[model samples]
Target: MPPPSDGTRHLAPAKVNLTLHVTGRRADGRHDLDSLVAFADLGDVLHVSPGDALTIDGPFANGVPVDDRNLIRRALAAAGTTRAVDLDKRLPHPAGLGGGSSDAAAALRAVGADLGLDALMALGADLPVCLAAAPSRMRGAGERVDPVALPRLHAVLVNPGVAVPTGAVFAALEGHGPPMPDVLPAGDPLDWLGGMRNDLQAPATGVASVIADVLAALTAAGARLSRMSGSGATCFGLFPDPAAAEAAARRLDYPGWWARACTLNPSAP
Candidate 1:
């Protein structure tokens, strides 16, 4: 049965890993991770209404699978329900932004899926966190998530039109890095974040040199701190406020690159 024509809208915010540490490799070949995660205010949107087929339309929709392979459809299946989803794919895939996972989590939310965190992790390592859609400390193989308080962050996100494969980046990794301190620092989170690191950034940059350029561009644009998010391609530049982030985003005029100024952990509507 098709969903009602009530036109329910859901926002699937982009997931950003402000600081990611590769802890160790599991016996099963999975790698453990310790990271600070946040969500960007701007991201793909979904509209649920009366229809039979899934439709995708947005600036970044090209090449997105519309078949059963799509995470949204898979999420619906996991929830034992189906609905016509119109996905506005605003974020780029494989850009280290966790766009697909976020979209899947939004579909689950739209249908009010009651799946537990473990079940959500089975869908995707990012599913649990994306479903939470808040600042969190993620550990293990992305299964452990703990909600944390964080100050709103102003940032410019940039993708250099290059897709760095996650597997490739992992294959290029040299070794695991140390995890965050047992207790996060008090006050401004940015100060503590600067001391942490995304262990995948170097390997991802090696897979796609353009990532380095994106980081450099952000730094040159007057960002207080610039670093790669998740695995590769997409990088973030932290600024003092919205005005600074917006200005920095405008200054990043690379052709074919996608850049947006967004607030992480924005106030509820």
Candidate 2:
């Protein structure tokens, strides 16, 4: 609120979909989904200062749009803040990680907007969970968000530099959907997540074959469990701890592939 006291920084953590079960298709072509989402410690950063301009800089900032098309711009406009926003982009774009949405959510909270759920949904399907910045069960095209406590996860994220369009993957899907269980089985996070899967993975692999390679590398490098997140091309592996996850990432050295070890933020209230 009030530009976060000016010059304050906010985190835009990477959104990881541990489980995404595509259910049914709506009349408008929107797909219904049930997903369990968590935020990663590794992600982009945003800084706010007293001004109206928006500036972006980071390793992955070269081709990101900076105008109204950018979610941050729209978010700031929606929040009615003119704070000079500087985004430090770290996560790879179109990598199945909701980087932009997370950044926008951070901007909204920074501006102290009290918009309702419907308003936030207008920003993006992932915006609500990103705004909460916590582990939650997301359903019905992301309109329903219920925060849930989850054990911390040590994970390695890998992107093969290929952007997989979400629409294409969905279009390539063969079946209607396999509905996810209403209640998630509780236990160790890794074990529970290992049994679940991203329904989009098969179709997404058809779009980007390299995604298969990414998953293979992760598994071969000693990952207990590995799968693609969200849509495609950016896969993740769950390890026992940060050290193991980091070690697995380092071992899977592929030229031009982006890989990092991060802990999933424990459930936030």
Candidate 3:
């Protein structure tokens, strides 16, 4: 059955890579990565209506071209829907927040009921887990997922007002980069994440080293763990408590960088 109203609203959360180890580059131009993925209690809002066309709107709608290249459009097109897709912007773009991925997931499961997580999995990696809206380990070309128990973590996300293109960052590696860890540490998630790593950090740092500076600054601010997500620019620091995390965020002096303090989401069902 078609959706009752013009559309159904859904919340799409930004993602934090608790651990991202880019262990190796594969033969088919794909990067081999092992990442511990977690969702934030905070994210953008999406309203998907079954209709005749696609559209997007919000307060932060600048520069987000409503074109065929946009992930939401691609997702709706892939799902073979003509829905009027409206996305209220919240998460930073290309700052490694996984905004596009999350948006695509929303369009699929929330908007197009005919397609589910498994169906979208074949469309794009990260879509399935993103639809799940929980923390999971994504591995083997981003196909494998292990949904693990994660604690409610407090964190601050800092993004220098720069859009770091994922392709460019990966291309900058020139097919040469560090590899993902063969085995992650076994312990409490906080402890494990504290020791976790991001494989794309180096190339991302090379493209825009300010990300490295952000990591340093967050570490100086008493962050237990700090690392870049997805590709570049946007970095996160995990603290023990919400108060402590917000306190640290308030002290950051990156006037041009976008920052936010949000609690880490407990795993979703």
Candidate 4:
């Protein structure tokens, strides 16, 4: 893909986990999470214009620091696209969903600026999935992602206006958990995933009890499968259609809470 046009760019949306399980711990003390990662129909939007600086704006902006730790900054540094990169935050950070990673993936791909997906997978496992930006399988500490045809699934993402610290959740984990499945079925991967699970939810829930509450809400709303995404406070529930997910999100409404209807984009939905 080529770089973005002179003034604008766009990012695909993001979603929380419908199920999160921490099956084990790693030698590096990282938890092996077998999460059902999905994308939302709505997410933070980024506008990029090649310039000499970086800027960010929008709601949920108070705490997001502008520094080297900012993934956008790092991505630009890595991609050698030194120009004005403007990010408007639509997603909350550290909410169990990879909002920041998703944002970074969008930014990186927006202009084809950052290190490509291949180089980034070497940086972190989740980075690859973010690059793929589709509903697929993510396993093996995030280093592995394989595209599989997923069942058309709709969901609602809910975050009760709080950020769950991922590092802290991983720190609380007791083991490296479990290994990735050796092979997944070749068709309708979502059906196959009904048998798969996230290995990190228990430990993550221990650290952020809201995660449990969120899942409960999802379940109460008639979600077929509800789980916390990544290591988070954001929870999602899978449903049969957009109407179902939207209805569930409606009945579970909280004014200050972050919520949206999301359909698993089999390809970057």
Candidate that would win on lDDT? 1
The TM-score ranking, best first, is 1, 2, 3, 4
Compute each candidate's TM-score over C-alphas: 0.95, 0.94, 0.85, 0.84
Task: Compute the lDDT for candidate 2.
Answer: 0.85
Model 2 scores a TM of 0.94
lDDT of each: 0.88, 0.85, 0.75, 0.69
Question: What would the per-residue lDDT of candidate 2 be over residues 39-131, giving only the tens digit for each residue?
Answer: 887788899778878889999998889889999888878877667889999999988899989999888887787768887889899988888
Off by over 4 Å in 2: 1-7, 266-269
Better of 1 and 4 by TM-score: 1
Could you give candidate 1's per-residue lDDT for residues 166-243 as a string of tens digits? 999999999888888978878777788889999999999889999889999999998888999999789999999899
> How does model 1 score by TM-score?
0.95
Q: Per-residue error at 196 for model 1, in Å? A: 0.2
When 2 and 3 are scored with lDDT, the better candidate is: 2
Model 3 bad stretches (over 4 Å): 1-7, 112-123, 174-187, 267-269
**What are the root-mean-square deviations of the candidates from the true structure over C-alphas?**
3.1, 2.5, 3.9, 3.3
Candidate with more favorable, higher TM-score: 2 or 4: 2
